[model samples]
Target: MESPNNKRKRVKPILRCSTNEQSERSPDDQLAIIKAMADARDWEVLDPIRLEGRSGSLHATMDWAVEQVIAANRAGEDIDDAIVYDQSRMGRTGGFAFGTHKQQLAAAGIGFISVDCPIEGPHADFIQFANAEAARAQAISIAASSARSSQISLERGLRGHSTQAPYGLDRLYLNAQGEELFIIRKLADGTSLRLDPRTGAELERYPKGVRAYRKGGLETATLCIGSEEHRQVVIRIYRLRHEHGWRGVRIARELNDAGIPSPRGRHWTKDTVDGILMNEVYLGFAYARRYTDAIYFRHQDKAPERLEGPGGRKVRGYRPREDWFRVEYPKLTEYLPSKLRDAAARWQAAYWDRYEDGHVRSPERGQKRLHALSGILIEETTGQPMSATQSGTRANPKTYYLLPGSHQYSSQESFLRRRIPSAPLYRAIIDEIEMLVCDDDGLRDILRTEILKAEAERRAGDGEAESLRARYEKLGRKMESQIDLLGEDDDDVMRRKVEQTKAQRRAVMERLAEIDQGPRLTADQTDELVEQLIEALQSELAAFAAAGRPAFRKLTEMLIASAVADLRSGTVSIEFAVPASMIQHRFMGMDRPCEPKWRTHTHKWKSLPLAAITVELPERCDMDCWEPFEPKGCDDCRRQRRTA
Candidate 1:
């Protein structure tokens, strides 16, 4: 014990880890190991350091000690040596067990010693390697067990939560007051309440003694003049967009024009309108989870990055709506009327299905050429017309042709195939028209006849009837003005206006009839005759359907067929027709319809030789009953009959 020259050497601070072992050793094991330190005397004075472990178990103690040793080494400390009560105290096997303890000691420039093996260093190769392997295996086992526990919790809908709270809901936990802060509850007065720590308020209790207090809804409630009124407005908006065929932007504009106030009392923008339309709360249900959260790991920022979920790996980052939590928030949106709610639900479903199946297209991105051609095609057989399937609304695009399984055309594929290769038929019609119109004078005559017959009439002895004539003429002017306002080529609007004008004209004619005298050439009689003549002329002009005048049904059929064929083969052809007005304006050679004229001799007896007929009778055909093309059922057959 010694040479005076070996004067007391300075002792380094040391750290140690102790873990569970099969064998039980007491303080003697620790005390003996401590004695192996470089400055043995200092071991007597060094206080025992303890670290908190998982439990009060020995394994936990060792886990803590390992952490301490690793930390000390990182801080550049140089403890001379670490003492372990036994091999298992540090780890399981000799190699891995001692290997871990020795690695820690070596990292801190300290040597390791076991009480029973005083001559050995913790840094010895065998011990260091063994300890490392054992410690790694323990860590892996713990991880696997933790994962299994998490999986079980998920299956049970329990959560590890990691102290994380869902949005609009607080993480429930016992605080200093030992009270459940997030549990739903009914107070003594039977009011629902939730603990809001930020405001230091016990909000209205919920049924489950747990609830996430909603700030927006609460604020809306406070500001809402009447919840029913606000809910009615929301219902109206939803119905108009989802049920009534109004777009979100148009709905917003309509609401603003009607002086309706939005929930925020600001001008409604398209985005705001879209938000309202897309909101599920109005149906008395809504998923509290947001797409932003599902896609992005966090949602603190206004714009967050999209996160690809484990499930999203197969199909990009979209999560099915069914998978989202459908929380029933009883009050937030309960005010919506049942009928409106049902309608909105149906519309949303249809639109969602369309979106999912790639049936919807966007105009902003510019539609494909085929889509544009499809829009112009109308189905001749059915009254319905085709829309461009490739562009426009993302939810309900204008489709060129109806789907194959559609009730309107169950055999759509066959119908399209039969129609697509009708180029020869179309060419024949074109050839016939081209040859028929070869003589310009004959063509002009046809046009003149149609135009003149469409004009109104007048007769002699109608002098006293001028007042009624003027009234009729005034009505005609109004009708023309309305037609002009409606513009051209917009069938829906034009058809509506035409119906309205016809009703008004019918009333006028009825009034005229009531004032008419017997067929004695009286002033009233003459005016009545003139009006009847004009009406007859209109009927006759429509009946003399020329070969070049397009058959409305055939045109429609061709358009629909062309679109469907394009969809199958991915080929498209476009034809542009300049509007008559544009053509007239751009070129001065065309003749405009003459201003309405009122005359006696000029109107009644003048024949302008306006048309000529060179009928091509199909050889050996029965002129009395023969018809072209297969009957597309009754309505089309009736139209052909009337025109013939």
Candidate 2:
């Protein structure tokens, strides 16, 4: 018995606030204002959809709320209108995104209303367009102002805003009088520990809360060496590189093996070690204005146009070296001495020279010929994977799997050291695989043994999968809590922590998905699968043989996991890629099964003996010694050698 004119319009109110907006209204404040307006207008407001700590410039962030409202309207929920505190709250992406969203809402029979900018009647569209353009202009102005402030800070030798201190260093805050206040040390748990500079006493522990740390007014910050433990690690890393000429990969391996934690408290990687080595911060210098925000045109041939707002395809481009602002910190010299700094520079130069030379002289530099066992072929002596190399003339090419470091040593020293001819090794391995696959009884026995092994492993992984699931849920809650607590004035550090947590959660989710998707075939299923595989393999093997080397390469890659060759000892050890059960499961038109723990079996082939595998010389040579191949010379000669 309700009249149409007096009937309340059902609407959902949307609220948004980004972390960068310092004076912007909070979601709660916006909701209160919206509710007051809705009450006065006699509109029925649903529970508000809040977008906290999400950027207004991104359409993706607002798309979810828009879609939900539209979906509800289409499902006969009687959503008459979608209301927001303001048009900018919906998006600052100019007319393109904001106007497009408005059109979408209208098409779904839902009116879009901005409470603050109420433009009804004939000129409503024009007024809304103007407001959106104004919002975009404001965003650009704010970005420019931020850039100018950062430039001024860099020029004045004060630490640039929100810049985190590099690894092995801590941020030291100074008062206006240039006196040290306290040093902040970031911990592995994303929390920070503050220390008294003079006494090294713990000041306080800053929890991972709304703010990363409470910033004081008129304070400047600088980098200083961290704890004694970290200082020693840094010194050792420098010494390893400068004195011993160790590469980043070798350094990373050594650190990982020693159980030394990386900068992020994870396992050390070559890139991580290299980043530490290449950082100029270790040598008493801080650089700023190293990068600039840029928007690239999709078509390179077309002239670029000025696109307002963050909707454009944005990118970070490196600024010119001359434009960079460099600030010197004499205090850093105490940590890394002048002598050590010079040594590091020398080491870097030598390292790059070696890197470039190796690339230029690489045996498989330009060729695309497939080497079946490229990654899995290991040299027994060094435990390093051998790279596919091509020697001899282009007309008569000789392919081999040569262990790395051949470039570091002379041709004479690298002649037959840790090297195996591809032809003989490939023939031997393929022949063995053929014999095993062709024999029905042998294949069935292999499948039975593998199925039992796989079942046992699957049972073991259940416990691990459970643990991962628990961790994944915990991480999800942690991320949600962090997001909820984020304030409008929260700095980059807090945002980064949230992002890192999200990344960790994503990784855990992916691992759990893998565990879930892994095949858990039963005994009967395994027997039926084996029969199908034998029939499929017989047909496939014939096609593969007829197709030539490319097909052979594919077959080898599928069947083999790894092989270790001791060239001097004339022995080859092979590890199959997967269990016979999983191989059957894969060929039966299903997802590839998880790799099983391969057991290496050594084979001494009669057809291809040590004499055939090893490089043979037409004439005898005087150097018959069996010492490890050194780049400079044998150990005796190397020890006696002098450097200028």
Candidate 3:
């Protein structure tokens, strides 16, 4: 029998590639080279760990591979060595970090080895340190070169290397001869428009979530006016700020209600709106180098020589305004007039003054009241959630749940056009619940129908689940076969094919996992679940009269999934949270039940007439009630408000 110490040493190989650059050797090539070296030394190589598109400067990036080797050594599996394709792959953070990581492996009784730069004997430490310093120098050189190129591009009146265009702007690519190649229009809906450069004709419209075409070699990009629709929207945003003095949040709300998609193809937010308002790009100026590189590696070390500014404070990374590179684009000037731009600037300054003087307060400030239907309430027209807002003084507050932009319609005569009073709406919803509980036969019939429907849907999905399982297995085998075909002389094409197969296998695995996790039930189980839910609901109802607001809120959270308000139809549709089929399974497992798959029941509430509500206005106002007040009131009212 062979002696234990004489047996081939078991080693763990680590392979890494910092970027997807074609010139850089791939992790697969590195692994293959490391394995060949291991075989030559008669070493038993364990499954290699691969990391791609990860920076070598960050020790945290290699922590997963390091921990595994250390763990195996501690568990008596005896990982004799931790080997890497090259010393730079260990780290590019100079001698200190590299040496520290090596020491950590040594402490764990695992020897560190680099296939490319194998150092041994007394000079090993010095040689390793030199190699690490070289890597650090190379990293710094590359960063400095990139920064220089960007500065040169800016100086030449180009837009630098940034590919992203702000909202209401398009990137026009120009060839070396200064002839327009194509215009890339990135819209607020996460879609791109490819236009003919000269005629501005629509060449193609890419679907949402598809990335826009990148500029090629010998091509430069400049900002230009985007689509007419987007330009009008931008003008309206400035108009709303300058003429109406509307805040960013209110503007975002208005845009959302009008079915205008926000930048990034998502709902409008306060930050997104404010960013557009503050951007100088719309004012015919493109600014770069507005922020310092405080987060850059050179500044991260906190070395005295590398730090900028006084007192060693970073000033939150904002560079001086004078230091910023400002280039004027005549094309952008036509997008927004100078008059509107100046008016917007003045309005912004005055708004800040009002905020500092305590005349303006955010809607969420100092409000502690809990809204029972806050998240669950939805506006049917937009399918957007209703947000809670309060008016009046702190002592006598009146809360309402309404579509965010509907505040502009507060003075409308129709009840549905305005806000929904929280107290009255909550009362109406509880009344509906009580009526349902009182009729046992009706509730039972509804529950039975919902359970049967769920069973039928589940039965129909069985075939699909089986098909997914078979597909997942096939993908798994395909990936394994491709991986086995990989060799020392394999080309880039074969390697890419293997990677694609791996990605497909991962997608199929995720789908199979989702299907397997869904709750499964039979016909017998469904009836028992329905009865259990009715009993629970009845118990909840018995205590409803005496239940506090907190108790009632909790009950609603558990029982109601969502409530949609149809303003035009004057109806509120409700979907219960715990479907009759899922109640027993959820209750037993303590899992949160999924939303009901059946159609929701609609309930109509009595509308509180606008004429009934009296309003008290200032003495300067001639209006008897709020109903007659236009969104923009008369000149006298405006002057009076300004004077106050």
Judging by TM-score against the true structure, name the best candidate.
Answer: 2
- Per-residue accuracy of model 3 over 1-644 as CA lDDT, tens digit each: 01131335678887877763311357778888888997787676777767766677655665556766664554335466888989988867678777877888876557888998877889999999999989877876765555555566666655542447788888987888888889988765556789997888999998654455756555677889887888888898888887788988789778877878877666676788888887777877755655443212221111212333321112234444445556777777767877898886665556334323222122234334447777567877778778788786787566667776453332232344446656555655555565565456667777767656644543336477678768878978887887787785765777899879766765655444333233455455556666776776667766654454556665565566557776665556665544332353333533224523221100001111101111121222122322221111112344234433
Query: Candidate 2: which pairs clash?
Result: none
User: Model 1 Cα displacement at 421 (Å)?
Assistant: 6.1
Candidate 2 lDDT score at position 392? 66
lDDT of 1 by residue, 277-388 (tens): 7655555554422232221132222222333432111112223454344434343354556777777777666755543322212212331233323334434444333543
Against the true structure, what is every candidate's RMSD? 39.1, 20.1, 18.7
In model 1, how large is the Cα lDDT of residue 285?
A: 54
Q: Rate the local accuracy (lDDT) of all candidates.
A: 0.39, 0.62, 0.62
What is the descending TM-score order? Answer: 2, 3, 1
**Better-scoring candidate (lDDT), 1 or 2:** 2
Per-prediction TM-score, please?
A: 0.23, 0.41, 0.40
Clashing pairs in 3: none
lDDT score for candidate 1 against the true structure: 0.39
Weakest lDDT window of 10 consecutive positions for candidate 3: 601-610
